[model samples]
Target: MRSLFTIGLIASWYASNIGVLLLNKFLLSNYGFKYPIFLTLCHMMACSLLSYIAIEWLKIAPMQRVKSRLQMMKISALGFIFCLSVVGGNISLRYLPVSFNQAVGATTPFFTAVFAVVMTSKREGWITYVTLVPVVAGVIIASGGEPLFHLFGFMMCIGATAARALKSVLQGLLLSSEGEKLNSMNLLMYMAPVAVMALFPAALYMERGVVGITIALARDDWKFLIYLLFNSALAYFVNLANFLVTKHTSPLTLQVLGNAKGAVAVVISILIFKNPVSITGMLGYSLTVAGVILYTEAKKRSM
Candidate 1:
């Protein structure tokens, strides 16, 4: 029964992750919402509200407090980074196909390793480092083959990937102590509101009339509100499912599932969006995923 519950959690993680991605793509690309920053802000808003309800009202996870000013500052820094990653990702989806986006995203492990070594002077084994070569090369090959390649989108996606990796590395360095280290759920509870605070001003500056536009759009079509609401809900579920899966299983398991989830998302996205994909693009994505798997194995062995 416990195993079954874990399976359900894993499934929920995949579903929520994929669902959020597809919905973001639909709203931005097909539905013509085009306001990536505002959309990301909405996601953070949902996360903030849902996390509060879950932790405070429902008592889903034991509430954890920020231990000190320094810890709160660290969490705030993480929130800023989270805003960068999520906003960049949403913007990239506006220009890039979901299939291609996942291909580029698969290079995250490469960035993570680089950031880890640079930020912490932590060195993985030579074999582990070698695994990153295919990861980088695959993205390059995919870029050359992608018919719908957009330079700005590619760059934004790369930025998002690097920001994500940096956040992971910094989390280890900044909150390594027992007193400072909060569990994922509580961490999200704190980070979500901080992210919202960071994103609000930027969204106002970058997307000046997005609020008015969103309201006008919703007035014209009530379904827009429904889609926005559902999309934001899915975003929160993605984070919740992620925390639950990590709690129930090892981080290694979560990493492996994440890799598989990307591939599954790619296939499902191609089907749903009917995005044209080349053989070279598929091959590159496969290679990247293969490299990530090898990297995971090598890291496991080293540990």
Candidate 2:
């Protein structure tokens, strides 16, 4: 049934995304890789290969037409933004606790909504706007009402969040365009390679020389490599699910579900790292999770 497919897709999407966060925590902590940009490059490379092969071999998209220069260029630019979303988040982990990182991420759905309106020139209802307030408030509470984790570092988190928001909006724009046909595989094929390339110079500069890059890769711990692979797979998994779910459900539902990742992420983070959970944190986490579920339920009823 259509409904069953939608349910399964959402479930798979959430699992993969939350899995990525858990693996990312491992990546940030264990990898000898020093540069955010460099680590991101490595991650993007892994995704690129997987996507390219899948798109070409599986022929995921219908043979509608090849994308035009203008559309391809737009996708490339969004690719760069996507790179920032990862690198910036990687950088943020250096300054903030993993739980804190996940907490701030709770605001993603609200920002997704705002970006949607701006990108599509569409109007959202009052209830939709009202729902965002609680999501955000929960995030603040979860963060212990902390101000920026570190001045520059916290700013980087904000940048990452903004990039994430933009990615969501841009995805809507790109996917909805009349002449553009992209399966999830096609989009990732275009993005991950280009994004990896875009990060090379930044990564190179940060490392200062080939020696730095060599040293980072030379350690080559098996455990760490496994984690990196996990990171790559998780990144692609949720993404493919995102596309498939979009086909079956509404974007608004996807956005709402996306917010719950923060809660799932926070719990796992606390389990892995023994993160301190304050009363405020408990309250915030509960509220954020409840709000996202409520919003999704309300949306389903309306439909």
For candidate 2, the lDDT comes to 0.72
lDDT of 2 by residue, 70-136 (tens): 8878788888999999999988876666777776666666677778787787756667667777777
Count clashes in each candidate, considering only residues at least 3 apart in sequence or on different chains. 0, 0
Per-residue lDDT of 1-303 in model 1, one digit per residue for the tens?
A: 999999999998999999999999999999999899889999999999999899999887899998789899999999899889999999999999999999888899999998888878999889999999999989999998898999999999999999999898889999999889888788888999999888888889988899999999999999999999999999999988998898899899999999999999999999999999999988888999999999999999998
Summing lDDT over every window of 10 consecutive residues in candidate 2, give the lowest-scoring window. 58-67
Least accurate 10 contiguous residues by lDDT in model 1: 178-187
Name the candidate that leads on TM-score. Answer: 1
Q: How does each model score on lDDT?
A: 0.93, 0.72
Work out candidate 2's RMSD over C-alphas.
Answer: 3.6
